[model samples]
Target: MGVLDQLRKEADQKKLSEQETVDQQALRAKLYKTQVLPKMQQIFKYLQELAEHLNYLEVPVQVENYSDRFPRLGTLMQKDYKINTDGYGGFSDFNKLVQINLTFYCIGKGELEYNVQTKSAIEQENAFLHAKRVASKMYRLGGAGREESAKFVVTKKIPVRVRFEVDYEQSQIKVMVNNHTDFSTYTEVWQPADIDDAFLDTLARYLLRKDSEFVSLDITDEDRNELRKKLQSIKHKEEQERLRGVTEQKNSGLEKKEKLGDKMKSFITGKINR
Candidate 1:
């Protein structure tokens, strides 16, 4: 523990004289006053300084109510949507937040605003149709996503941020699409999902191709048999539930044994006392 404690312990075992104990204690007090305490104080202060530098804490993010009335004036350009490391953030997990810095304006006598929606949510409706075409093609390819001959879902959902602003009197509207994002060099590129030949080609051909520039294929048939097959494929991911059931059974057995042992111990103790 400490030099003084060690010496005192040694002295106790060796049966030192009272005068010697007093003398050593006095010497220790002097050393503490002159050397040890000051050094310990310095070390404590250094440690406190180091702790302040090492400390890292999460910044509490304020969630904006999308339906709330707009603040009189503020800039998204002035504020950064900080990324959270603990897996909770304003945006989705896979979102590559392309920073856009633009001033929200109220022109003449009107208020201004923009509506945001995820590209994934829009495509998820048609996911079954994509899967059906994929399965159909996979038969020709002879397999699925495996080492052997298989088909890959060659479709990816691309996110788009559509900005439409209306003035307070509702007389004016602005619809803007940037060749480059509104701010700092369009840096965030997030490929959220991978697609194989079937879905991609269908979506591209139906909505995003040069010939399909005016069309958007956003709806899907959920009652389709292809959708049911997709659901059936992922149906039994219950291994976790199975493991939990086993653990619960073991714990229950242990609890029953403990109760039985307690009852036996009490009965034995009663007999012994009698």
Candidate 2:
């Protein structure tokens, strides 16, 4: 091939690569706007509702939204609860911490990801442990220990980190909780329509139970069932109100048509009389 022809070929390939990058970014941005943003908002609402539902349980919950930070990414963070047990073993007190972060990103094929990190530590009266425990016992049971049961310890006060990734294009959800001690992963493939408020609420419950080892958040199963019923009732009421508003609009339109007809009839009568 001639030098000029080679140069031309290289330029064309470079242009094509740049265009591909632009196309990928544009597609990701569109997915972020339509799918990711709505899901993130729904997740925030779910967490807020869950927090309110668990209020009677006196669970210390904090939910925050960072949706305005687009281009960079948006996040909904929930710090579920914190508790420290009475001092034991001379000077060490067991502690539990649960934090779940749902973050949105417009990247690659487009995705929404959530990372949940739990820190269960043994704090000496006035100091933190140097080698903080990576609470792996949460997943040690339920056949998860087949990975490394020896390395996974079950006592309270150890820290753990688990990540959940949602792939919008693939319609899949993946979970992984790995540390220096143990490594475990789970995948749940779902229909596109299944990713909604109800599903997210269920996920919230699952993550909390998994990380906290179902520690009584001072809430019983009955209490959780009641919360579900309350949420359903609120949704039904909202649907009723929406239908009522639509009916009112239809009635208003009918009234306007009647008034216009009456005006026309009066004009015709006057014209015929004249």
Candidate with maximal TM-score: 2
Please provide, for model 1 over 1-274, each residue's C-alpha lDDT reduced to its tens digit, 9 standing for 90 to 100: 8999999898887776777778777875665444443333332333234224323332222222211223421321111212221223333222221221121111112223222223343244236335322121121222355333322222211112222222212122222222111111121111111112342344223211124321222223343344445334333333444556744535778779657755655543333221
Q: RMSD in angstroms, all models?
A: 30.4, 23.2
lDDT of 1: 0.31
User: How accurate locally, in lDDT, is each candidate?
Assistant: 0.31, 0.40
Q: List the residue pairs that clash in candidate 2.
A: 120-157, 120-158, 120-159, 121-157, 135-159
Q: Please provide TM-scores, in order, for all candidate models, with all chains considered together.
A: 0.16, 0.36
Candidate 2's TM-score reads: 0.36
How high is the lDDT of residue 187 in model 1? 18
